[model samples]
Target chain A: MKKTINIPLGSQHIALLEPVRFSFTCENETIVGVEADVGYVHRGVELACTTTFKFKQVGYVVARVCGLCAIIHSTCYTLAAEELMGQEVPRRASYLRLIANELDRIHSHMLCLAHTAENAGFEALFMRTMKDRELVMEAQEAMTGNRVQFDYVSIGGVNRDITTDIEALIRQRLGLLKEKVGEIKELFENNWSLSLKYKGVGIITAENAYRNSALGPLARASGIDFDVRNESAYLPYGELGFASVTMSEGDIHARNMVRLLEVFESIRLIESALDGLPEGEIAAKVRGTPEGESYMRVEAPRGECFYYLKASKGQYLDRVRIKTPTFGSVPAMIEALKGANYADAPAIIASFDPCLSCTAR
Target chain B: MFKALLNALKNLFSAPATLNYPFVSSPKHQGARGLILFDEPKCVWCLKCEEVCPPGAIRFTQDRESYAYTYHYNPYLCIYCAECVRACPDKAQALSQCSELSRPTSDPFMNDAWFALEKEAEDSKEAVKELKKAKKTEETPQP
Candidate 1:
């Protein structure tokens, strides 16, 4: 006898903030096929950017698309506008932007790790990780003056400069943060329950990850050595000696490990940028209309966030297109979900760190 | 089995590393962006705060006669970005370190009742001062 089993998970799962529905066809305990339906939280941000607002104001609106990866959205949009205007931002502004971006990455990856731990029933680890994550929030407040939607980046350059006091404060905090991250890593590595829950679950081979064009730690965890920071060489990342960390496991455990290691790498990048801190104007004068379309990409906490901007003579943009990382990885997520156990569905789903807001936007 | 039980027992007595958040408050830095607060008297009606706000949370209108300012804040829309606080020309008109940003209503838009009341009180005080001045002038002979 042939029997069909259906397990449907809605967009309102406790583990997810945004809505994404998943239907898993399973036989006994093993998933046979998986289907996903998104577009629940689409706010038409890109559509609004082109019609309603000027090109300069769109940066803030784009940043609001996702609260976690706001910096990447703003940075990518700024880079596109800069390309269109044919303006090179000053060295100081670029370095300051990189500092804010790295701080954002630290906070975002830490929150994901905390959420993963919470979902895995590791409350102690979740609380401990979040406690350590507070340092980045404090550092962000010190630098950009806000923890979330940092309105520090502008069209021509950054709105603020990093003073001697702020630089010294960041260095001191980073030193302490490095020590704490090490302790947390040790704890995560030693926890047997965590290992059992994540290891060998949601397996995505390096070859498959590349074939699907996975970005950020998802691809890197599968041993794909591709990071836009290393490839594109944007801003301070060009000057810093940051290497993409990769692993071959390609499972949930490997992805989590990759994120943890990337946090340390982010600290190193921030330190190097601060060491070679240049003294110059943070912003440059920008004028004239952007004539043609320009494409810019940045490595967000999740993956590659790309923006395509077209501007005419008027202040309003002709068209603004955003391709977020989550959108790119959704196909790979459905592939990973196929043939997996029904119990491991949430783990597999969260393994990609699916930001439905970014995807829908 | 015996060895595993022994190891578990040994781990159970180790010191608890987590901090009690509610019972013990962590040391907050002076530059922390906490909740926003407004002082009515020091405001100069410049409206610079409204101009620089990234989110359109702050609304200000100038009074007709008194020259005092009326400011409205929709706490629901406020992301606590601190742009308004940073843009405040008067240093006293910025956000405070108190971040208890909760409200009873389901609507996030009506969360700024405290700020609304503060602005109203200032307006009422200005109105009363004008009334007292008019009363004094009426008691005296017309010049």
Candidate 2:
């Protein structure tokens, strides 16, 4: 009766949004081991960054790395490029960047929550969450002129500025979204079936989280207090009173709770940034090319997104390395998947919200 | 359990959340980037759009005798980031979200419609310039 069987989850599956394969070894119904394959979606973004795109345009090129966190990719690349050129972004542009980044976080978190709900067989909850997510999408489109892949951030500053009309629209939509998120939070917290599927399942302890270098809501759910927004001086997150939300439990429920709580914090940060929006030029004049090598890190929805650029006084970059969060969190995801019930596998995977696009790119 | 029952009751009275596409029309925000638009007259033939396009979606060729340029656009390769739109000095390139999605094709002519567009624009501008020169000659009183 102690026989082991191999089960392959996906390079393609209904439960997965992107192509990532996980082979699980299960003894009866309980998983004993996991092996992940994450190279399905890689389109040679690193090679393209150096060969195809110029320094001025690489900001937008990196935005194509991951659709969900496109703004963050551009922002991080722009920050590094600005650092290389010794460019000082305007205060208003900094505030706008903060606003856009937080909006992206809200939408991405909602998407993860929706996917989790769908994977758990709560089809109604998935639909409800997606409907609410549209509010944030509307705000993003109104601000940056695109729903996803905004290409909002440029090297010196942002490409667009906010007007009173855009501000009012964002405020109104965020207000509506806050209410809907509250309802979703109640469902996640008190719903009996959700609790049964999520509570104490696929747990990662604080030690494992640290050992595996897990990050974003995954690490925070394990009580590890680390967020690039708090630590980095890249944007105006500090002035906006950015606070990283955390929870002690590291279950699927705990991860969902961390995301839900962080949505409120992100809303608060956006409101504060918009309230203190300074009046100035949206972009700065660029006179010189980026020369020196520099590195930048940003907190994407899943975790830390890092960019390393090496330039040598040319229009083309010498080297570009993007180390996305999902790349580092794969080991942790495997560790969590091991010892979990095979039936609970999809739900656990959905909880991590592993973005293979970002991982492979 | 009570909340779930109440939620089910509330859902019974509410309208369906899903959009009836093609019948009700899809939702698009005003600033959403959907289609690439060109103003051939306003284009200065600088080739900045070609230079800055991330996926090489744009192709440009010029005729030396006419001093007119031909531009081609492949929507399939375009990422729709509107980098060319931002880079346009004369604001010749633009994006609109309300456009219909094209069926994907590998046909060569389908991707080169932008060349025909630029050619039409150049011919029209040439005609207008000739007409303006003729009117100037007529007003000069046989000088």
The top-ranked prediction according to lDDT is: 2
| Candidate models: Cα lDDT each | 0.79, 0.87
User: Which 10 consecutive residues of model 1 chain A have the lowest summed lDDT?
Assistant: A183-192
Clashing pairs in 1: A11-A20
For model 1, residues A126-232, the per-residue Cα lDDT tens digits are 77778888888878877876778787787788876777788888888888889888877775677788888898888888878888888888898889988899889
Scored by DockQ, the top model is: 2
Model 2 ranges off by over 4 Å: B90-108, B111-143
What is the per-residue lDDT of model 2 for residues B1-143, given as tens digits with 9 covering 90 to 100? Answer: 68767988899899998788879877655566555667676777888887887776776655545646677777777777777777887545433223444333455555357566546555655676787788789899874
Q: How high a TM-score does candidate 2 get? A: 0.89
Quality class of the docking in candidate 1, CAPRI style:
incorrect
Model 2, C-alpha of B50: deviation from truth (Å): 2.9
lDDT of 2 at B52: 80
| Model 1 CA deviation exceeding 4 Å by range | B1-54, B57-143
The TM-scores of all predictions, comma-separated, are 0.79, 0.89
Q: What is the DockQ score of candidate 2, to 2 decimals?
A: 0.46
lDDT (tens digit, per residue) of candidate 2 on A72-191: 999999989889989888888888998999999999999999999999999989988999999999899899877887888887788777889999999999999999999999999999
